[model samples]
Every structure is written in C-alpha cells, then in structure tokens.
Target: MSKQDGSNRLVSGPEVDDSTATILHVDLDAFFASASLLARPDLIGRPVVIGHDSSRSVVTAATYEARKYGVHSAMPMSRALRLCPNAVILEPDFSLYSRLSKQVMAILDDTSPEVERLGIDEAFVGIGGLRRLSGGANRIGAELRARIRRETGLVASVGAASTKYVAKLASSRAKPDGLLVVPADAVIDFLHPQPVSALWGVGPKQQERLARYGLHTIADVAHTSQERLSAWFGEATGRHLAALAWGRDPRTVEEREHEKSFGHSHTFSRDITDRSEQEGELLRLATGVGRRLRDAGVQARTVTLTVRFHDFRTITRSRTLPEATDVTRVIVEAAWSMLEQLGEMPPVRLLGVRASAVQDASDHGLLWDDTETWGSAERAMDAVHDRFGAATVVPASMLRRERKRDDTGPSGGD
Candidate 1:
C-alpha cells in the first residue's frame, strides 16, 4: 500500500465544521506531468512520466497512474521505465510549469495575503482573517481548488486545518484531486492513528529507529514521555517528535522577503572522468551561484560543494569564510579547496554549488577585501553580459572548455 497514492484517503463530509480550520495547504496534482499534458489532451488519464528520455536523466514528475506502478519523481528514468513500460514519456517544460505556478500563486495571493509558497507546486495559505470576506476555510479551499482548475485546466488538492502541520498532512492525504478539512477539535483523532512515517521528520532510517522501540504509530510516540524520548533521540529531536506526535505545531504562515540560500547544479550525460573538466564544471556552477547572489544584492558566508559519482553516491562539503562575499573567484576557490580535500575523485555524474548564510551585500563590513581586483573585473564583465546577454564574457578557461565540449558533441546539461 503506497501511502502517497491516496489509497488511505480521508476527507471531511459536507456536514463537517471548518470554522476553526483556518490554515490551508494547496498542492498542484502531478504539476510537471500535468502541465506537459495540457497540450496533449488525449493522454489525460494515462500513466505519464515527465523527463528527458535518457537513462542518464532522472524523472522530474509522474502521474498518479505511473506512481501506482512504482514510478516517481527523482527516480532514474531507466528504473521508471522498468516499472511502467507503457508510461507516456514527455520532456519537462519548465517554462510552462513556471507560468502555471505563477497563475496558481496569483490566485492564492488574490484570496489571502498570507500565502507562503513552498515551491512551484505547493503552498501554505492562512485564511483566518478572511473568514468573513471569504467563506470558511473548507469553503475557501474548495473555491481556490475550483478556481485553479477552471482557470488553468489543472487539478489541485487542498487540506484545511487549524495548524500548519495538520493542514499539510491533510493535503497529502487528499492527494490527486481532493479536499480534506480537519477541524481543530479533531486534530488528535486525525493524527494519532497515522503511522510514524507520517510524521514530519520520520524518514526510512528514522522509521527503523522508531520501530526498534515499538513506536510505529503517532499514538505510540504521543504516549511516550518526552524525557524518555529525549534520552533516546537526544533533547531537541525527542521534544520535536513528542510535540508533532501530539499534533502541536505553533508555526504560522508568513511571507519571506529573501531567500536564505542560492544554488546551481549541472548533470552530465556521461560520467566525467577528466579532472580538468570536473574543475571547469565546478567553476561554471560557482559562477552561476555568484551571479545570482550578486543579482540579489546578497553575500554568502558559506559555500557548499556537492558531488554525485556515477554510481549515485553523493557527498557534500562546506566551508565558512571569515567574511561574506559575492565574488565568483572566492566561491570557486572555496569549492575547489573542498573538492581537493576529497583526494582522487571517481567519475562524477552531477556537480552542484551552493551559497548559504546569506546577508544583504550592504550589511557586509568592508575591512579588507581579498578579491577586490577580481571582483571589480567581474562586475565589469557582469555589465557587459547584462547588455549583450550571457556567455558574452566568460573566463578564458571556460571558453576553451566550451569549444572542446562542442567538438565532442552535446553532453546535455543545464
């Protein structure tokens, strides 16, 4: 029984009261796959997979039908094909997905000002203040789902509850195209019977740990003392689990003014064995991350490097600088330093660069900038690229590498 296939679906009946359920979690159903299907109406209810049809690629999205056959997003395309041999495979249309995402977010923004977008496919919306202007939370969720479908020809599922945790859980339970409203008075009843895996922090490893202690359900964790939980999982994690098990979530939906991190990643068509080529790709990724930080007027204190080997083994290393910076050279150097520490690397399939611990560039103190000259040159290059378009100004090494890659035919990366 796949938990995510809506086999254990629960929903509120028409007579259910939702006056106290003020929070809503709305999720687009099969977002990428559905968006790709908008142009191919004949494949409406069939098993569909959205991704590049390459064994090297990963599945970006899959319809519920495909999911029922054990195909899912982030799974390897080869494995997904093995699971659902007849599934309709389509390339991902990111631009189309973005447009629909904006349309959906705009509808939520119109309904309430307290919409917190989690990603392109889901968001948390608070409707407590709109009870009078709009209807109850359940009604508002239904109307919003209706509006999304009517306006975009896409399906959305909603979960409405008094707490964000319960609201998110409700939405997941009401997957595909359903609305579930869990009243405040019934929060405990709705939560306790669920499996331990349903809890926010419980992944497969956590589930095994919980099961070793016979904590297989939310009720088991709720019944266990926080002190004992603390003794087992340490103070913070134990307390967190106890609180969540009892349906206690104090978090509220709030708008974020800025992102906490910036990142970029590139996947290779083949396992990259050349050390110079690997370094070049890392530089390219760092350049992208730095450009985004500069564009956002932010500086990062930490840089992270992520490497995935051809065998799918992944590792991450991070370093914190004494001062925040938005310079590509600094980011590249930091990332390279971390990569060098790993000794000789195996063939890599993916490389990623991430910048975190970000702050407004204006807030950074100007004591002694190490890359001042290089930073100035980069800023000038940024201006030229902005005027002429990207790649108009790139490192000489990158230029040579691009020509070399072109000579070898397309390697398929973004």
Candidate 2:
C-alpha cells in the first residue's frame, strides 16, 4: 500500500522474493458493455448500459462514460435513467457475452496453463514458472494486454504482484485499461497508509467496527495485536484480516475447479399461482442450468428444484438421475417432475433449478443402447449449437413459447 497523494498502491508480501514475485490479475474493462460495443462499433466511445430496458430492471454493466453520470451495473434502470437520461440502454445478450468469454479464456490459456477464471471478465494467471519463458511478470503482463487487445478488440487492466490480494488490488487501482506491478520489498511501505477497506475481507460492517476502535488504516490494523483484532472480528475473520494487512496470501492460480452444482434462479416481479405459468418458468430455469453445464463441459447427476412461496418460505426437492447429462430436455423433464411433487397452487415469488453431483463431460454414459444412440445425436446438436448460437436450435416447446412471448411484446412487468 504505497501512498501517493491520497491513494494507496497495493504492496507485496514478505514471502515474495523481489526477483521471483510473479502473479498477475487480469480484468476486462466494462466487459459486457465493451463486448457489446465491439459487436456494434458505432456504440464505441458512447455511454452504453447493458441490461433490461424495463423500468423495473437492474443494470448488468455500464460503460465508463455512463459511470460519469452515476450509472453502474446492478443499479436499478429507473434510477440510472434519472441519472443519465440520454444513456443508451440495451438488453443483455448473455449468449454472445458467454461466447466472447470463452474466446478470452482461450487466450489466457495460451498464455499460462495455471489460469484461474474469477468471472466472465476477469482471471488470474500464475507466471511464476514462466520467468524463463517470458523474461518476467512485467513483460508477461504487457504481452497479455497486447494480445487481448489485438485479438479481442478489448482493453484489459492488469496487476502484477506476489499475492492474490495484492494482485487483485493492484488491478483495481489500474482500472480503465492500465497495468501496475508491486515488488516484494515495497509491501509494507505500499500498504500501511491505506484504509482498512483496502483489505479484501473488510466489508462495510467490518470497517465500521474497526473504525470504532480507531483502526481506520492498514497501518492501524497492522500495528494492532492479532488477539485484539480477533476479539473484534472473531477468530477466522480476524486471522484473515491480520494476514492480509501484512500482505500475506498463499493461494495459487490453478485450473478452474469444477463446481459441485450449476444453477440459476429468477425473482418474479409479482407472485403468481398459475401452474402452467410456473411450469414455463421452471423450463426456462432448467434450460439456463443445462446450458451452463454444457458450456463448462460438465454434467450433473442430480436435479434439484427450489420453490419460494409468496410468503418467502422456500422448499427444495431433488432427484438423482440414472445417468449424468447436460441435455436440456433431460433436465427440464426432471425439474417438471419435481415441480409436480410440490402439490397444487401455492403463489411463488422465486423459482430455481439446480444440477448437482457434477462430473466431467467425458464421464457421461448411456442407460440403454437406444439412449446411447440418442446421446451421440444430442452431442452433435450441442456442438452445432455451440458453434452457431443458442437460438440456432432449441426445443420445439421453447420455440413456441419464445415466439408467443415475442408476439406479446416484451414481458411488461419486468
């Protein structure tokens, strides 16, 4: 946390040797909006907001220009419009964004095998073993930025440091497409004067509590005894904070781990009790989960459906499949069956679909000879869909509902 003027630069840890500290954090700039702008060059340099256009919708991403007018992702569209009336709001094209994210991840894969994808727009690549291959972290970061720009037409901010926290902070500091590096020797000098909020685990509530103890800055927290900090933050959080204050993190960049489950849920603008409508919503949720599983090259053996009643009480039910699958039809059927077990008419506020007991895609097997043949056919269809687009092919039921929805105009209640 090197202080310059009013800001603090992220510092490295003592365990990091000055000559060997090689960690990199990569963050795409205004990812969704930027990718949208790339597809539509006319929108470049303009204030772009990617999200639902409905008044009740929340923003998913806002360009830097939009940020100037106080527009930001996760903000209500109604408020964003009030803040920036002229801003161009676009519906989120998740399929396109997902495709582009795969492309970006592929680029990072070429750079380093030890890459941990944090989200669609960011990842950490360990270059500790690549010093001989790329000279140093600085050169590696520079090349990565250049490659991304040249290949994807997107700007990326990068931070190089010894620890994950420091690297992440450095990347945040190097926002709007920039790069920064923190050497090991400067860790304490760089971190001491910064606010405690600079530490990863220090959320607003924790910050307020620390402030009560006159521990506002990293220096203050660093000087405070670990026992005292633990008493305030509890054992785990306290220990974590103290270690971070000293610029200590032992996490490593590794392959993206397969999740135990894949799921998606939606909160309705208003609760409803129509069984047909609820079934339709469940199908959509199932489709979302299945798509994600296929995209990640994984399959789930158990399908779980969760129903949140209008009163907010939630119940979850799951069923194990005879065989793991990434097929949308298989998942949707399983979810529909689970929904049937919930009995009649209960107004629902939220519906969710979860696919758990995951396994590698290669682990999929056929239940019968005919099912094996269908599995090959399904794989072919998945390949075609992946190569073209999700909407290129879909279940007939989905197609009919989509057409009906389009005909009825946008879902008005948001």
Cα RMSD (Å) per model?
Answer: 6.1, 5.4
Instruction: In angstroms, give how far residue 249 of model 1 lies from its true place.
Output: 1.4
lDDT (10s digit) by residue, model 2, range 1-414 = 111111232323334443545889998877777877876899787878777666646777788778778776667788989988989977666556666777778999999888997766788998888898676776777789899999888888888889988888888777667777788877788788778988997777888989999999999989888999889879998888889899999988877756568776766666778888778877777766777777778888999988888888999999999999887778888999988887885798778888999999887566745655654666676677778866776656664443111001111000
* lDDT per residue as tens, model 1, 230-322: 999999999899999988999999975346787767678778888888788888778777876776678999999899898999999999988
Local distance difference test scores for all models: 0.81, 0.75
- Candidate 2 residues lying further than 4 Å off, grouped into runs, are 1-18, 257-260, 309-315, 368-389, 400-414
Clashing residue pairs in all predictions, respectively, total 0, 3
Q: Top lDDT: which candidate number?
A: 1
| Residue 396 miss distance in model 1 (angstroms) | 13
Off by over 4 Å in 1: 1-3, 274-305, 309-346, 355-414
